[model samples]
Target: MRTIIIQKRRQAVFIGVLCVALIGIASPASAAIHIYTIEVDAALSRMEVVARFAAPANAISARSRDAGRFLLDARDCDNGDQISNRGRRLTISGNGIRCLSYAVDLRSAAQADQRNDLLHASNFLVTPTVWMWRPRLGGDDEIRVQFRLPNDVQVSVPWRPIKTTDNAYLLNASPQSGSAIAIFGHFDSSVANIAGTDLRIELLRVAEDIDAAPIVDWIQETAYNITLAYGRFPNPAARIVVFPIGNTPWPSDSPVLFGRVVRDGGETVELLIDSQQPMQSFYEDWTATHELSHMMLPYLRAEQRWIGEGFAQYYQNVLLARAGRYTENYAWQKLYDGLERGRESVPGLSPNAAASGDERNSRMKIYWSGAALALMADVELRQRSHGKESLDTVLDQFQRCCLPSQRTWSGAELFTTFDSFLELPLFMNLYRQYADAAGFPNVRPLLGQLGVAVDDGEVRLRSDTELAEIRAALTAQRYTGGPGK
Candidate 1:
């Protein structure tokens, strides 16, 4: 099962490959190797990066597609030729350049980052999209970035770590889901080994003198909780960045305030938390679980974001119930309440429209519309296979074939891929019926059949219904059998 990466994130994969083939200049395929060595200053104020290409390259630039993001003070390493044009693209000579160097004014970049100013410790974050400049890696192409850091300083990057080497990582092609961040200096970091996976955890230092032990423990526990999904976490080596923005201008009630899974160079879960809260509060917050669950699928297109958000929303409660944090009745009640909110919000917008609509108006619809679809598909799959098939098993098969896909996918594409793992198609039918309709996915009757009854805005679960066992199985935790854990 080779990883299949469709295009539309960075330089569009097909176009890039075609460009490589056209702009041959007779360069060998092996000449595509790029080695970037970066040295960080002790003050966390600046970085000096040197990129050495195996063969001369004509065009080399940062991976960020956004305008106004460019490397600073770039120059040819061989000669003192400066890269004067600073409009995002970096090229030395029309002929080609073998070695290039650049300097990063880290303090400025960190200041530009909204949350970095809140980090009052020895650490500061400047997203790598600003500093990591290199050529496009095509077939068999690779880039190795080695970091030379001061003592007591640790670097956290969204790239695959080279186990044998220190402070080195391999950056391959990725969906570039959001700009992946790079943290430098004295950030508290560690590796949490859970379910045969090694998750790198970076806890950003904040104003308060917080202990990192309990917070890391809570993260490890949360990761373990997600393992109950289909027996293990999705990505084997994912990065978790914990930003502790204590009671500041941006205030949030949640212990884990906000969490997002970004798959730039690799999958990284960024969690914003209020460190003043007790450890138990973190466990109780659904933010971390919701974010972690996002990794179970590929990055969906921004227009079809409901699929990702809804799937995560659906799993957050179900996984919580399976982990015993939420009782089955409570989970059903939560789902029922969420569906009501979604159905009531954005009167004429469909799930697709809601997902692409203004966040201020379509929040509930965007979140729960997909949840409704997930629930429908899960129940249908179970009913079709007589409890032998489920969203969990389908996702498990997907992980075996394609879990961390390197490209953004349409809602139809994602569902079609999932349907491939079954005897009959399931997700696309649901998609076609409700995706563009100017109404929320109608699942109320289905809920009734599944033994979910609502009385006076409260959910009551009944076991005597036709689909009672399947309803029960939805929240029941299955044994983590076999090798995944």
Candidate 2:
């Protein structure tokens, strides 16, 4: 039935082409596209959205167009009105069309009917109206929208009925650029509201520290490092809302101390950092940079959570060292410390076992410990490849191949990809042992190759070769403190 309907519409569009051409293409012709916009006001914790079709006057009716049924693809929470009721609303309006039936992606028929009725009688014609509520939990939300048009004009928005898939909408159609799209509401929040681009963000508050110049400089430096290493912005043109919550008495794990990413509305990335933390210090700045890196790995796809977390951790140090903020020794020391801590947490956990899922126990072993292993793998790979092909290149390739989608890769898949970039398969074999086994593999020997020595829980240089190389790298780069320090 769905295929038949599509075929009929295709045929109708073909026949209507001659009529459309004869009517002249000067006036804006509505295409059979889907149009959607989400508006969010963080101050009030409210949101709204409107999705409708702007078709030509010769289009069909609601019944003919599948009874106005639309798919709601929401993430981060259950797909229903419970979350949407929290200061969120959805409104629909069109000419000569009344909504007949509505269906949410994962919601039951009863729930769908209730929400649909709410929008049916509501005043959706009002601009900047309520669309839908964001779920309370911090994650992502999407809606698979289906609607009807009065005529056979232009279908501008592409219909995406799957919740897991991203919904793309053409936000702008200019003569110069032709067309620009907003993916999964991952539009530029700064300009989304003004342009009705289905992307929005709110600044909760600025950092209390008037001397936030250091933090800002650190952010820019991190961005610069990403570009230098990968030839692209960590989050190119993406919206990042920073909230500076002043000195909190509690620790970093406090709910108020952490930031959140609102995945539902447009790919919104929120960061909440404690101003009390010394922003000038390598520790504090690294935290900020690491969190910010999450914006780039938007989909949380890598089965080895360490790929995301570990890379961010490694880069935080690399960028800081490059910017003369931290010495190469300091950066390597940090990596060494992280590795030891991870090893202690899970004595014999294999990398494969660690990368399997996101369970709490698994996360500790996988996200933290696994991250340390990845760093070791990276260092080994760099040395083997004579620094010509480092982990940065591997990540760049991975980003090109696997990012922006919540696709998971198994341990084997990860190794295969990494092996493709390397001459020897030593790293692959090592990675498999740690990843697939439940026991931890010995990485102390690998660190030896880099001329690093671990003495009674301390990571330091064993000989002049390692010490000289590190010193040279740092001296050549002129290692200093972070920006504005």
Per-candidate Cα lDDT values, in order, are 0.80, 0.42
Clash count for candidate 2 is 51
- The CA lDDT at 94 in model 2 is 33
In lDDT terms, how accurate is model 1?
A: 0.80
Candidate 2: which stretches are off by over 4 Å? 1-33, 37-49, 53-202, 206-215, 252-256, 259-268, 276-284, 294-303, 352-364, 406-411, 421-430, 466-485
TM-score of 1: 0.88
lDDT of 2 by residue, 310-338 (tens): 55666666655665556766766776777
